[model samples]
Target chain A: MIAFESVGKTYPDGTVAVADFDLEIASHESVVLVGTSGSGKTTLMRMVNRMVDPTQGRVTIDGEDVAATDPVALRRSVGYVMQASGLLPHRTVLDNIATVPVLRGTGKAQAHERAAELMEVVGLEESMASRYPSQLSGGQQQRVGVARALAADPNILLMDEPFGAVDPIVRAELQTELLRLQRELRKTIVFVTHDIDEAFLVGDRVVILKPGGHIAQIGTPEQILAEPADDFVRSFVGADRAERRLHLQQVAGREVVVDASGRAAGVLEQGGTP
Target chain B: MSWVSANLDTIAEQLLAHIAQALPAIVLAFVLALPIAKLANARGWLRGGLTGTAGLLYAIPSLPLFIVLPLMLGTSIRSPVNIVVALTIYGLALMVPSASEALRAVSRETLQAATAQGYAPWARFWRVELPLAGPALVAGLRVVVVSTVSLVTVGGVLGVPSLGMLFIDGFQRNITAEILTGIVLTAALALLLDALVVLGGRLALPWASGRAPRRRTAPRDTGQEAAR
Candidate 1:
């Protein structure tokens, strides 16, 4: 479990990124923080890992306050994935995945073996194992980045716009992969993205952050779509959110493309919602 | 033609003796440069001072340095120290920048990834940082070997038993063939040293073939892994 109790950040220059944020993300839940550029969602997430120290209040991971923990140790147990896939260009896909494990006292042979397994888990071809990040396409590199994050088996994964760099098609594929991985790993993932659709799709809990580190609304996707907190939340999700809701209702189930006139288009039954 | 045929044993004796002297200085320089380069990467002022010292050493004519060292240390002219000092001067000069640049050229993305992986600071420098920067470092060492060979030949100015002494003796005797022999052997030796450096780099740094990473891995993760 992760909790931010009245956390705030006031930079040395007097700029306030987050102000009095109070949030709790339960274990085994994928919570995505979404907002405009300066809404402090990224700052808030970084605080949990102690990447950025909070000026006031405390961020607790499990039961201990992060401020009291060593930053390196804190970060070691937390998997972080940044956009651009942040894969080490000098390392092969397998080595990149083995990086953290090797650091954490795993021997070279064991670490590499685990990395190979992670590559499989992340849906990468074994042939790509020897390739560098530059040698892989954008999507493949991003997948390797994800695999590297999962290498050490951290209980908490912090992803900052992990899929923002990919094309829509590849983005969808990654999102699906993430969902499957989440189901299997059940990690306490704190994801940050600006796309409301991505937030709705990937988040078990979605946070709409207003400017100045204020949370406009925090709830599940269904709750937020059905009942927006205010105009800010409603606008961020867009007017098409209601229509988009229909898409979610059919998720992971089946594809039943029908004509506009409520008639089945292709191999539809004569009576099955045609 | 009779002189060439009759002096073959003498030529072999001189060549072997000269090589024995030159090889030690070159080998010492190669070993010394690796650690100095590693040190230079961490301390800017030390690097500058050390590099500046190397340049200063190079500026002193090999003849003078060889003579001066014996005078200052009260060591005999025939001691290996004089020759070693001259060769090491060139070695450091050549190795300083090559090693430093290799260390500096280490990519930030690689460092970042290593940090994220939980490597402690020093560990990164040793395991991920040094190993990844291997090719450039070895290339730098290659330059060192060549420079050492060249400078150790110069060490003969102090009466050291070196290839330079062979060349100098040939000059003294006006034996053009003997002089040509030293030059040819020295050049071949330089090339052989270079080839060895390249081979060492490839074997030592198999992972260095990939392009540099855009980011540096964190120092923390690097230290942890290196320490392990």
Candidate 2:
């Protein structure tokens, strides 16, 4: 469990990034903080790993204060994934994945064995083990990034717009992969993104933030969609958007679900009454 | 041709002396420049101060440096150490700025990623930063190698007995072949050392070579794998 106790961050230049923010993330829960630029979503996520230390208050993991821990050791024990994949361009995929374990004193051969297994888990071919990050496609590089993050098997995974650089199709594929991975390996995940749809897709609970890291709303996607807390949440989630309003319609004598835009979303299942 | 044949032993001795002086300067300058460059990269004031010092050091003429260095070091004017030390100062003048630029070329994202992955500062420097800076460092080294080799000839003016001695003796005696031999040998030596540096770079950084060709071919292999 990660807890941010009234945390705030003010830069040396006097820019208040996060002001009096508070949140508690339960163990094994994946929470997404979705906001625009300057909303401090990334700042909040980084505080969990001490990448950005709070100017006021504290962040604790599993009832232990993170500030007291050595930042390097704390980072080694946490998994971090970021935009642009962030895999070292000079290292081969296998070596990149094997980095954390080797740092933690695992023998080279043993770490590499674990890395090879992770490559399979992350959908990379055995041949790619020898190739550098630059040789891989964007999607493949992200997979390597994911593999590297999972290499240490850390309890918490911090993903900051991890899919933002890839094309939409590839982004969707990675999102699905993350969902599948989460189902099997139930690590506590703190995801930050500007994309609300992505937040809804990947997060168990979504945190919508306004301009100052202030929570506009916090709820499951269904709850937030059904009852927006205020006007800001409604506009941010696009609850009033035509595409979000869905109804059943008869199409070719079969009941089909259609959005307010009249676009057919799917066919209504026969067993479930609408 | 007769003059060349007569002075073959002398030429061989000078060539060896040339290598002895130039190689150490080339190596020592590079070794010293890396740490200085890293220090300079730390802050704006440090960069300005260090690079300014380098530029001032480079501006001093080689003959003057040779004469001045002997006085400072208490070495004999004709000692090869004076020549080596002088040329090393010259090499550092050229190398420091180039090394600074080379280190700067490593992306911030790569460094941050290494840190976030839990690499200690020293470990990150060795494992990530240094290797990524390799190609640029090699490029800087090639310049240092050629300049160092050519600069060793200047020591002959101080009676340091290098390839430059041929030019001095030939000039006084009016022997065109001896002068020609000196120029030819010096240029050839520079080229040889430059080639060696290039070869060493290729060997050390295998991933840097033929990047465009690799990029074109790699996708096909992966595409085939994807089809399976």
Against the true structure, what is model 1's DockQ? 0.18
DockQ for each model: 0.18, 0.41
Residue lDDT tens for model 2, A1-274: 9999999999999999998888999999999999999999999999988888999999999999999999898989999998988988877789999989999999999999999999999888887888877777778888889989999999999999998988777788889999999999999999999999999999999999987789999999999999999999998889989888899998899999999999989998988766
Q: Please, what are the lDDT tens digits per residue for candidate 1 over residues B1-228?
A: 455577777667656766666677667776677688778777888888887777776677777777878888788987877777667666767777677778788877667656655677887777778787777777777777777777777766656665676678889998887787778878888898789778777666555554433323322211222221
Backbone clash tally for model 2?
0
- TM-score for each of the candidates: 0.78, 0.95
Screening candidate 2 with a backbone cut-off below 3 angstroms (N, C-alpha, C), the clashing residue pairs are none
Model 2: how far is A41 from its true place, Å?
1.1
Highest TM-score against the true fold, candidate: 2
lDDT (Cα) of model 1: 0.78
Residue-by-residue lDDT tens digits, candidate 1, A1-274: 9999999999999999998899999999999999999999888988877778999999998879989988777777899898778776657788888888877778999999999998999888887778666666677777888988888899999998988877777788889999999998999999999999899999999999998789999999989988898988888997444344332123246555444344434432346563
